[model samples]
Target chain A: MRKIGFSVIYFVLVSVIFILNYTFEHTAMVSYSFWNITRAVLLIFAVIVFPLLNRRIYSIAVTVLKEELRKKTLYVIFIFVALLVSLIHVFGKIAPANQHVFVGEMGLSGITLFGLLFGVFMSSTAMYKEMEKKTVYVLLSYPVSRQEIVMGKFIGNMISILLFSFLLSLIFVVSLLVRFGPINSVIVYSCFALMLEFVVIVAIATTTSTMLSSTSNIVFVIIIFLLGHMTEKITHIASRLEAQRLKEAAEVFVRVLPDFKRFEFKDALSLGTVIEPSVIIASLSYALFYSAVALIIGMLIFRRREVDRL
Target chain B: MDHVIEIKGLRKVYRDFWYRPKVIAIDRLDMEVKKGEIFGFLGPNGSGKTTALKLMLGLIFPTSGKIRILGKVPTDVRIKEQIGYMPEESYLYGFLNADETLDFYGKLNGIPRARRKERIEKVLDIVGLKHARKRRLSDYSKGMSRRISLAQVLLKDPDLVLLDEPTIGLDPVVSREVKDVILGLKSEGKTVVLSSHLLSEVQTVCDKIAILCEGKLIKEGNVDELLTVNGETEIVASGLKQEDISRIKDVISSSGGKFISSGHPKETLEGLFIKSIKEKQESKSN
Candidate 1:
């Protein structure tokens, strides 16, 4: 009954947002984008898939989720995003002709920025906090294996990040609706792609966190995030160089870094370009494969790492 | 014949970042704890009591030597189901309330929901924290946190329990209660390995003890055997006058025995504190 009550409250909150969007549509025509539809579908899929995990893994994930919820970081981010969306009128006044596009871009950018920041920060600190607080001692003393702990933290943090993405997407969607009747397909795809990118970033953060201090982990994750985003550009510039050795070195660097461009559909979204379904599928698959490899590496390192430092 | 814990030449050397040996926390030490015994591990700070406990729990890797718990390698995950460990410090998640903390650990041990709930209540009641189970650990006093830690240890009713300094930082009354709980566990035929620097506490409850100094086992034997004086004896007689005590001493001297000393027996501060508190509680109830 408590769960039902919470669900009803959530439903009512969403309905209120929808009603607000409808009311605002009279002043400015609302438009729906393909990206918006894709995000809604993806979120629904995540909601269904997360619960199917093993009980032990699911319990760990829920613990991590509860920890994050209690920290109130998610609420703070949501409130910040809410305030940012409400102030989108400033952007609209700046560019009247492309007001809706600008609004969508700002919303997507805000979600992407906040999502990446939270993902990297949370992932890097999750294991470190456990160790420093010696909470991991109690956890590791159980029958649970190291792999389960790593995987649990990853999945738990991933779900929290996804929920964050979903909330930001809703705020963006509402902002778009207020400015323009319906959101474009590009906006939805952009947000989805951003979420995929966050998955990869979180995996990197979790892996680094196994071996590095929290501060170092954050620095390393940020460096990777920047390098990942620049992989294509760096390779492109490298190919244009005269020296073959330098080009080869750049190629290795690019291959070593995560190709964040694969999921970076924001530029295309801003240009109002239609994203291919194959590209979306390929991007999602790449994110999953990369995330799996990163988590596996983290588990391997964590299994051998001595947790008796305290 | 039946050893619940066996360590053969176990050595743990912590290394620095450059792979240089930094400290030898545990030397080539060996010991065995028999089943159903409250075996006390006595050592001072930095004497490797904690290091040894961590090795036994497989929390750290041994630089050399071997440890077996329940006839399996220490690292065996399956063995942990039958083992419970309460560290020297009450290292609990501060955010979780006592109930949530127990529930979380119960889940980690893979206890079924119904059984876990039952055990949580039982353990909380045993630790006298049933009423304060909803209070966050951060809000708990040090003694309360230690009680919760002990409750979590017993939540699964493990066969082999390792308690490191269980009475450390606790009041005499609470400490006596913890000792009684250990005795209770012993009564149930559970094998307990307790480590503490409190000789008095260890003396009262430990059936056998191993004392370590500078990472070496300096002494090992039954508490009574190790503490018994070969040529002297202690006599306690209440309601005896000073003349009666003098007469008893003269009789000992006449029996070809040297009279060492004779005086009123002194009660340990812990014992006195416990008695006072118990009396106060009884009077309050009455």
Candidate 2:
């Protein structure tokens, strides 16, 4: 608890400094404070927070990672993805403006595809499979709470997603550097945005999975993902409609559903939107806050659920 | 003596899609099990014995009632730290070895690494799975799988243990070993609550028993007191048996009573159970 309290305090302190830096973009002191805050947050996470995470959650996370790691197919999947990207690079030679742009676009797409797959599939099955196999009976019989189980599984899936993203990102970036000689700095932001997007995707899947089966959960979350991308359009339609009832309903949905357009790093880049610091902060905070809410809701539902029924 | 478990007016009614009462899995029932006693939970299929155990573990919510285990509500995770539960089926993760499974459970209980290792060895030894500790559960025989499950349950050295059909599918040797383990737990001052359909097994280990019928407690008492026949007597004779038997017959004739045939000195629990049920039905019809 002390560890968590310390971490939260440090995080808020750093985030305040970071926002202040953005607000006073021209101030030398604020920029220096921003650098120090960034470094301190990274160091705190690596040195203090990682080791201080709840032991039960960490153990569960490791078990999940080990289970997926032992499957031995992740390597094949990565290789398969890299080969597809290489093929894309080959197609780039048919002569558009520059091959690097095409390669970067295709590479980022591959990362997003794999990361989403990792997040969605693992979240759906992590807890469901434990219950299906009745392995949960023993685990639940221990001193662990339903919240810890849900959080542990969520963290497990997140770690798995992180590793998959990193490996694929490496493959994409390495392939780009070798083939195109230079790469854009915008790709870093794109990867970060993709990861944040997955955080929401995985949390939504985790939340729905408590009540739904694996297949239904996957189907439901896929529909949610699709609808999330179209929330902007839905909001516009809600405003310009004559039917007050439907408009109210659409407005409710727009308020409830996550506006995925917030994480549209690629769109912002392509349109030369300058990627303001406040925009980046807003997207980051939205993704985190949304994921946290989804997880809490999942825990509450799972807390009330009967494991025997599961 | 403190009651290790106290359940009052416990009812669990599983609902349907429309939020209507569907099946009353456990009707209003009350039970108390004391510390250091092997409490047997006996019932036929679908009689709510398993449902009762699940309720004690807080795996399911009771419709209306209270359950306190180890002086705390079942849902409290602190009570779980002191309770060990083993379900009927020992189906665990097929991908894990016995050590890995026990280690995972130990970590869940927040046991330190060094103590967990020591406790793991002790439990593996108890379940007689020390030799197969490194073997993956998927490759284990049914008995081995069950033993490993038992080992996991004992990993935390819990104060109260709940076993649902602990020896259902095992051979006689293994079943006997499990019964012995239950007895050993009693010897160690730990409370054991076991649910089983095997009357003979329950009769052997249980000091007190509860007979549940269709989600209601039909009978509950000390095993010896419940099984003892009220108006029956038996005498064992050794030398001059024929002469003694003839004299007993003559005495019986003089007393205007017929002697009942007897082979073994003690009546089987199975026979008592059937007789009890028949008398119950006859009384209900009357």
Which prediction has the highest DockQ against the true structure? 2
Per-residue alpha-carbon lDDT of candidate 2 for residues A190-301, written as tens digits (9 for 90 to 100): 7777777887888788888888889988888878887888998888878999999999999998877877777666764455445655555556656765666677678778
Q: Per-prediction RMSD in angstroms? A: 9.5, 8.0
Model 1 agreement with the true structure over B77-138: per-residue lDDT tens digits: 77888898898788888878988888888887889999999999899999999889888898
Q: For every model shown, what is its TM-score relative to the native structure?
A: 0.89, 0.86
TM-score of chain A of each: 0.80, 0.81
Q: Lowest-lDDT window of 10 residues in candidate 1 chain A?
A: A1-10
Off by over 4 Å in 1: A1-52, A241-246, B238-247
- Model 2 interface DockQ: 0.49
Which 10-residue window in model 2 chain B sums to the lowest lDDT?
Answer: B262-271
**Candidate maximizing lDDT:** 1
Worst 10 residues of 1 chain B by lDDT: B257-266
Q: Which DockQ value does candidate 1 get?
A: 0.45
Instruction: Please tell me how candidate 1 rates in CAPRI terms.
Output: acceptable
Worst 10 residues of 2 chain A by lDDT: A1-10
